[model samples]
Target chain A: MATSAKSTDISKTDFGKSPINARLSAEQKLKLLTDMVRIRCFENESVRQYSAGKMGGFLHVYNGQEAIATGCASLMGDDDHMITAYRNHGHALGVGMNMNECMAELFGKATGCSKGKGGSMHFFAPDKNYWGGHGIVGGQTPLGLGLAYALKYKGVKGAAMCFMGDGAVNQGCLYESLNMASLFNLPVIYIIENNGYSMGTSLERSSAFKSCLAERAAGFNMEWAQCAGTDIYEVRASVQVAMERAHNESRPTMLEIDTYRYYGHSTADAKHNVVGGYREREEIDFYKKNHDPINVFKAKLIAEGVLTEEQFDTLEEGIKAEAAQSAVFADESPYPEVSSITEDVYYEVDRQTEAGRTGKHFFND
Target chain B: MALIEYRDALNQAFDEELARDENVVLMGEEVAQYDGAYKVTKGLWKKWGDKRVMDTPISEAAFIGMGIGASMLGIRPVMELMFWSFATVAWDQIINNAAQVRYMSGGLINCPIVIRGPANGGTNVGATHSHTHENFLANVPGLKVVCPATAYDAKGLMKTAIRDNDPVMFMENTLLYGEKWEVPEEEYLIPLGKADVKREGTDITLIAHGRAALTALRAAEILAAEHNISAEVIDLRSIRPLDEEAILASVRKTHRAVLIEENKPFCGVGAQISSILMEKCFDDLDAPVLRISSIDAPAIYSPELERKQLPRPLDIVAKVLSIC
Candidate 1:
């Protein structure tokens, strides 16, 4: 297990000072960078569209947490299942959800992932093994554990990664889930995205132990670790190591990723309201200009002479165009008809068996 | 056919289902190693092993949510809540997540899970464990609530619930667990949304469920012997997707109807029955539809208070006698 001292040192080190650079090929790095940029651009556009009243209902953007979803999902195979809380547009995009389908869903069009019934919070694509973007606070934790239990029962080699915010740590269901998962040694990774706050309440005020989410895992007798969520390499390494332990020992692990969200809890909250506006414009500018995950990867690629600045710009332009096209498709698509409202509530069928063959045919007079 | 107690019948249902489907699992506080709290799951962990028959921590919400997830992945899970009253702790998962998945997901997912537990009064388990909250689950859609009063119904209905593709809330009676009744030796399934006429008569239709149905039957026998008033008794096997047609038909035939429920009169199953009768069989009524229910008081540990709180056979008889 990685020690707290080493993890702390890793967090303090600058992005370029780390020995571990993303080992992806030039093409893969460019593709991943493009994916991350697409998510950011798409969400920014979504925010603009929401303000213009083009989109309706709760619109949760994945502006700041793109690296966590992209990095973790990139490491996962197609068969692995992913379940998370409502802040899920990034995970959906990372798992290969179509930009058009997702955008259309935001527009409440029939072509959305949930066919317009489940807007931003409840996107589901079973074909991709993306279980859901559950709206309930910590409701998905036990469900993710169950999915992993099912996989083990079926003798399959897949793990379930359950994501929740720092606020959801207080939920009793999560604690019980942790105990059960550890007891059964289920192949599950409980990822706590400790983005400093839960909604608007800071963790320091709410949580008794804010800095060490991993120590709590010891109460359940499970392995644990903490890593810098902003650093892609650290996030990837932590996930990879924890996932290995889970898969090999068939045990659950807790990974607390200390990250930050640039936007408010939801699209509705103002960024300047919380923590006495502790986050200065300089800090936001520093992170965006220097430590932005996409930009960091882009500079690495440029330093390696794998891709030029012009090529990277062209890729960004292409993704923006695709996102815009998706928006248009969603705009034109029709809302689900009313008749489908009662469908799929339950799986039931009426069957007929041959009991009596003797029949009398009577002609109507 | 063999005779078995209601509790043994439920055990048999779990045993048979687990043996038939490898994906079927059972979990609760003491369901596995300690045997079930009522011994309904006794000897299950020995036969199915720990993986299939798990004894979970006393976290109702977590285990129930796990059951929901397992069911979504084609594993038919039967979760025991120890007592139905503890369902309040897991209400968020049961009411919000499990019940809403299929509908909210646009039918993409189905919660094929069953929550089994002992419900209703008469056990002296005190106010906490004795209250009958089957009506609470009955109000939720995308869930089938069944309360079987007989061993035959328990076996058949439990089997049906395990095979069902939607979530089912199976309510058992603590007092009736030891009561024996005849059950079929071969495989059988009683489909949901079907009501059974336990006793047929023409004067009045006594609609009841769970333990109240047995009380209604007892009252029918007494009424026949004493006043010669024939009462038709219907056991509403499944509460949701209620057999409104059969109920309306019975009310139309009898003209006078008496609804008996273990729950309070307000917003109980009896209320829905009364509403349907008023709408469909109002003109056919010989008198106003009478309801026999528990008083609007919480169940008490005291025997006298509990007796006053619950619907008694005498209460049914008096209501029937008045209507007839």
Candidate 2:
């Protein structure tokens, strides 16, 4: 067996300086930059549409943590699976969900990814191997192990990435999943996005561990690492190494991405006067000033001669226009048919079988 | 046709399904190496090997949710609970994920998984050990709930539940695992949501499912021979997509109905049937729709209290006579 790497606290490791084993092609790098831009632009527009009453329910924006999702998405092969918690709009865009469909879903249109059924919290693109935008906290943790189990059972090579908040690290099912994933040698990468606060509770208050969120993973005999989530290259490089261990060694790894959430927990939390605030204005300014992922990446691109200052501005405008076009597409899409509400509640039963269906319920009669 | 134990029939179904499809997997506590706590999976582990018939730790929430996830990705998993009552621990996965995944995804994904185990409240087991959660699970929109009373129904429905495209909560009765019934060796399947008229009559409809249906059959014999009343026994094998037509036809014919179940009457499966009958056929009923169910309390551990707590043949007869 490969070295168990028993919780080698990589929280302070400089993964950005780690040798880039699988360098992205020029087109792929450009795609990653555009993907991050799209998520930022789209979510910023969501705030507008939400305030304008175009959307209802919770909208947890992934504004500052764009680099984490963009980096994780880079490691995912077309066949690899990605599952995440409700703050999943960024992950959806990162994993290549249709921009128009995703926006339409936010607008509750018939043409949405979930056919207007699942709003902001639930986005699914199984065709792209994006499992779902699970609403329940830690709801999709075991599912990551399950997908890996199936892949291993079928001798498939791809890994299943399960993303959740730092809050989800305390869930009992996640512990069970970690135990089983390690026991069975399943290819599952447990990614915990540690944005400090879980809902309104700070990390100190919720988690028993005084240190990093990934420290608890040691009990499950699972290899784990932590990275500064603001740097896309760091997240990409670190997760890529973890994914390689999962693929080549058929092992499970827990990655705690030290990140921050710009907005409140949900759209409701965004109203500062109503709910007050979890963090002070100065706390917000600290991350914004030092670790703006988009700007940081832009600076890196300029230094590397990938993008000039003027070109970056033009690219930003292009992304904003793309997001605006998606919003328009969503606006044009119709609401789901009235009868569509009852549909999809169950699988279409085989009518020919006497038992599968019962004369099509009360309405049809 | 061959006479076999209810557990063996379930085992046969598992063996056959595993043989037929490579994707079909059986998982639960002590289901593989230990041959199941009830020995329902006896010797199958040796036949199928570890990969096909596997054992899992006592983490129901994790394994059950894992089964749902695996099923979504082209694997057919039959997850067994040691007791159906233990499902409360993994309630989120069963109700939230298993029941809602198909609906929330706009049918983009389907969970073809079967969760099976005994759900009756007899055999001296206390409250937590025994639970008839048919009403609770069936109430969920996306799931299909099935109960098998006889050895024949057990084999047929267990096979069907395995092959079903949606999530199926296959609730078995602990008391009836050893019951013998003749099952055909030929390939056959009993479709879900279809009620079987175990015995036909015109005087009254004795509605029941699982082991209660078997007891109802015994009560029907007593009513026929001693009381001279021809009772139609309607076994509701499928609970969720209920056989309303079959029920209505029986109620229309009998003009009287008595729901017999070993579950609580407070919003139980019997209560649902009573309401359905009242709504659909108020005029057809010769008397008020009566329900003979377990007493409104936790299942008692004391043998005498437990027996008295659940509906017996006498209770069925008494309820039937009152309706008649």
Candidate 3:
């Protein structure tokens, strides 16, 4: 593969010696490692499917940003709500969406999570408390606040985690949502995964102020934090703190996670720019070879003797097999019937019918 | 039955629905302490308290999207757009998210949200404030557009919109707010996609909606007494999922049809009705379908220009009598 020249000039963020000194037990570390690997393998297979033209539509692979989703989702219980931007395959997997359903959705099949209509950008599973994989830049922020309001209204202590990219930080709705969330003390955690670029535009080019996104939280009087998102433990700690603040004090928080995406904005972006359209190929290679979330976790677990080499090998093989089976399931699943289009739009009960009936005679003779 | 103004009937419906359904809530600019721009939400803040009747910031897109999200989470939200013109700002959420969620999810989700506001130009509110968006929303597939012309229909349709499982654009009229009518002193819900026959005759069928429907009825009365043209008048309460059956049946009896609308003639509700008539009742027609509507220019602020911009009762009367 031809490598871009900028890759040589780009400096990687220093991976500080384990941000939190707290050591997880062997079982917990193994479980986290397995989760990360499952997401990595799943998304890798998705990219393969995209390359083969089997997965149509926009394919936004979360190859390099796995740690943020895995770490954050680990803190959420079944009752809490999660909404995120279009780069959402990893988040959907983290929230426990069936692999078969996720793959089928990408394949635009009836058995998919969104019944094949949403494709990749608009997947939603309310039962899982995953509101959506919303495509509109900062549109999901207010929705997250609304979900938190509903939970508070129902006297539930569940928090809503609203995720967006660095590029969406400038949307006017984000400011409005932040104000509302703070004014009402909504239990919401607004996370911005600062991946350095919005499509082909770098954060430096698009954002006037790039260093501290969390600083904007003060304008809304929100609690704020920043962390190295490449480290699962650091990401987990930051999310846990925000979750606690939201649950205990009913205060909203903003967490800025410094992260990156290994793929181009989408599969279609040639990713070539005079000033460097895509990140240096070497930078992607470095992340994929060394700092890959799955590899880092796997290395840590194996070095700590959390699992035998044989067990890790078996886990990888099993995950690969699972991903392959899901592809088959998606391939064989049928497309939604045209007649099914009109269903589920409204809930019509007898009460509405009776009410409509009485009003009928009002206009009748 | 009691006589109440359209505005008061709407207020009563909101108050009663909020009290009856704990899941029902209200949100919009000036809906809380200011009592709504049109005062249709008056006394609701005090009765329902601040939580149920929320006053949102000026971000229409955010609040409307929030309403959609809240509805999906089992809450029935009655969102006021302040004016129907502001709905254009939130079209993305309305058209892409709310309208398509149910079908996109394959029957997994129901967007039971009501977006209600006063539409049409009559109060001389000028171009910016005055707009009739029923035609624009009717083109959307997943939405139900309701334009209620009377106090009875306003209350009934609003209640039904709140209870509906899909997103509904409940369009009211600024001029009709003070108009009084007899309404039953109980809960009622007029089903969507049903038309109401305001008057029955056999000479010509005049079909309209919202304020235009009232104009058509008035025109029907005038044509009956003066021109000796007994025109049947139909109020298409809902624009989407149009009551084509009632319309065709009326046209069959009358043999001639006149469609009236506040929207411009080009791609307006009148055009849709005309197409439906042509397809369903072409063989039974005694004459071609005549449509009365505003010109395609933006509504001018000048009083004379505004008057010329609006489709008047005289326009409906002239079209119906001419066709007869």
- Candidate number of the best DockQ: 2
By summed lDDT, the worst window of 10 consecutive residues in model 1 chain A runs over A355-364
Error of 2 at A201 (Å): 0.7
Residues B59-147, candidate 2: write the lDDT tens digits.
99999999999998989999999999999989989998888887778778889999999998988878999888998987888888899
Q: Please give, for residues A1-365, the per-residue lDDT of candidate 2 as tens digits.
A: 00021122224554445666236555566677788888999999888888888888889999889998888987788558898989999999998887898899999999999999989988988888888899999989988888888888898898999999988888899998998998889999999988877888777777776357786778889998877777788888889878888889999999988877778788888543133555677667777787778877777667767778898789889989988888899999999999888777766452233444552332233
Write out the backbone clash pairs for model 3: A273-A277, A346-B165, A347-B165
> Considering summed lDDT, which 10 consecutive residues are worst modelled in model 3 chain B?
B100-109
- State the displacement of the C-alpha of residue B248, model 1, in Å, after optimal TM-score superposition: 1.0
Candidate 1 docking quality: incorrect, acceptable, medium or high: acceptable
For B1-324, candidate 1 gives per-residue lDDT tens digits of: 788999999999999999898888998999999998889999999998988899998999999998887777888899999999898888888987788777666667778899989888866667777767777887776677888989999999999889877798999988899999998888888877788999999999999999899999999999999989999999997787577778888888989999999888888889878887888787999999989888777777788777777888888889887868
lDDT digits (tens) for residues A112-156 of candidate 1: 887777788887776777878888899999999888888888887
Model 3 CA deviation exceeding 4 Å by range: A1-25, A272-276, A342-365
Q: Higher DockQ: candidate 1 or 3?
A: 1
Candidate with the greatest TM-score versus the true structure: 2
* lDDT string, candidate 3, B98-217, tens digits: 877776665677788999998888667777888888888877766778999999999988988897776889999888999999998867778777899999888888898888888888
DockQ of each: 0.42, 0.64, 0.39
Off by over 4 Å in 1: A1-23, A271-283, A349-365
lDDT per residue for candidate 3 within A1-365, as digits (tens), equals 12211121222442323343154566766767777777888888888888888878898878778889888887788668898989898888888887899999998888999888788887777788887788888878878887888888777888999999988999887888898889888898999987778898777667765347777898888998877666676678778888888889988999988777777888777872223555577756665676567666666666766777789899999999999899999989998897555444443421245422322211111
